[model samples]
Target: MRLALAAALVFAGIDHWLTPERYLPMMPDYLPWHLPLVLFTGTCEIAGALGLLLPRTRRLAAALLALYFVCVFPANLHNALNGLTVDGLPQEQWYYWLRLPFQPLIILWTLYAGGLLPRRATAVAAA
Candidate 1:
């Protein structure tokens, strides 16, 4: 699942890299260096996706993936808060608002699948 999430993120990052202008307005006004941000995130997605496929690095990759989500969250917030638009997405605030709740679900899945989340001790005790 983390691998799948990484792949999906790669696609999303590529979209941002491919069209920085479209995403630029959504980036937090306080942030600096859009070019590096776009490039670094694109590279991170690709590297993280590959890392997730390797058992030895899966945990670290998932942690990074979770962090990546947190890092990019401001863009989503900007979109929702300022009515920013993107291609291939519906131009509606409702759509952006609906996207907020998905962050935790996706981040949790990434961590769980990558084994970054510790197994519950209660489950072990019960067994």
Candidate 2:
């Protein structure tokens, strides 16, 4: 799982860098500085990938990453609603559908694998 998350983040970082204009449409037009937002997000993803590789800071790393995903959901929703197209990522239309559910699943898996959450077991009454 750690390997998977790290690999995904690294790849995603590269993708974001290569196609920042694509992300621009995702952000609100009112925002003045889109370039920083793009680079900042990319850097965070790379840092998150590195963070997930270690054991000591795993929980915080996963939490930060989870929050990151949650934050971008609105942009995805915007794309889906407007039927907008983004450069570099041609499949943006379908990506919204693919991206929505995976966020929670990723977060859940990260937390569960990190043992950050308490386990629940069913108890039975002895006769």
Candidate 3:
């Protein structure tokens, strides 16, 4: 799960770089330095993804990545609320609404996969 999440982040980071314009609309108008912010977040995603692979960095990476998700959530909310289109793809209101609730799940998943959360013990059958 950790590796899969890392791969997803890497792919997303690449997408951010490849088509930044697609993400521009997601940025809140009140925010400054849009392009740099996009690039910075993309870089962080890539770095965090790579960090997740190393044992020593895995926990830190997971924590950071979770925070990153939290930080960018507003953009996701904004995109959903405004019915914003991206890369010529038109999304329905329901689509955005559906995505809203998944953010916390992603955070919890990251924490668990990164070993930050306590592992659940399996029950053993009595002989």
Candidate 4:
């Protein structure tokens, strides 16, 4: 799970750098310096992913990442609500709406895999 999350983050971060224009429409008009902010977020994503892989930084990375998910949510919501479109992405409104629920799941996955959350205990059958 941790590895998968890290891999996804790395891919996304690289994508941010490779095609930042894809992210511009998602930016809310109230925000300033969209390009720089996009680049900075990409940097943060890469850093957090790397940190998640290290034993020493996993918890902090997870916390920050969860927060990052929360911070970027408004952009996602805006995109969905306003029906914004980008190249190479789905044109279906349902696809964007479906993505909203996954944000919280990613946050939970990050926290759990980073060891910030307690593991679920399973009941053992008595012999």
Q: How much lDDT does each candidate structure score?
A: 0.80, 0.77, 0.87, 0.93
lDDT of 4 by residue, 9-33 (tens): 9999998999999999999999999
Q: How far is candidate 3 from the true structure (C-alpha RMSD, Å)?
A: 1.5
The TM-scores of all predictions, comma-separated, are: 0.83, 0.78, 0.92, 0.94
TM-score of 2: 0.78
Q: List model 1 lDDT by residue over 1-127, tens digit each.
A: 6657767877877876787676666777788997778777788878877778889998898899889888888788888998887777888879998998898887898898788887676645555
lDDT for 9 in candidate 4 is: 94
Better of 1 and 4 by TM-score: 4
* Alpha-carbon lDDT of model 4: 0.93
Model 3 bad stretches (over 4 Å): 88-90
Q: Per-residue lDDT for 9-104 in model 3, tens only?
A: 898898888888888988999899999999888899899889888999999998998999999999989988888867755566787777779999
How much is the lDDT of residue 11 in candidate 2? 86
Q: 96, model 2: CA deviation in Å?
A: 2.0
Most accurate candidate by lDDT = 4
**Minimal lDDT window, size 10, model 4:** 84-93
Angstrom error at residue 2, model 4? 0.2
Q: Candidate 4: where are CA atoms >4 Å away?
A: 122-127
Candidate 2 — which residues are off by over 4 angstroms? 88-94, 118-127
Candidates 1 and 3, the one with greater TM-score: 3
Candidate 3: worst 10 consecutive residues by lDDT?
85-94
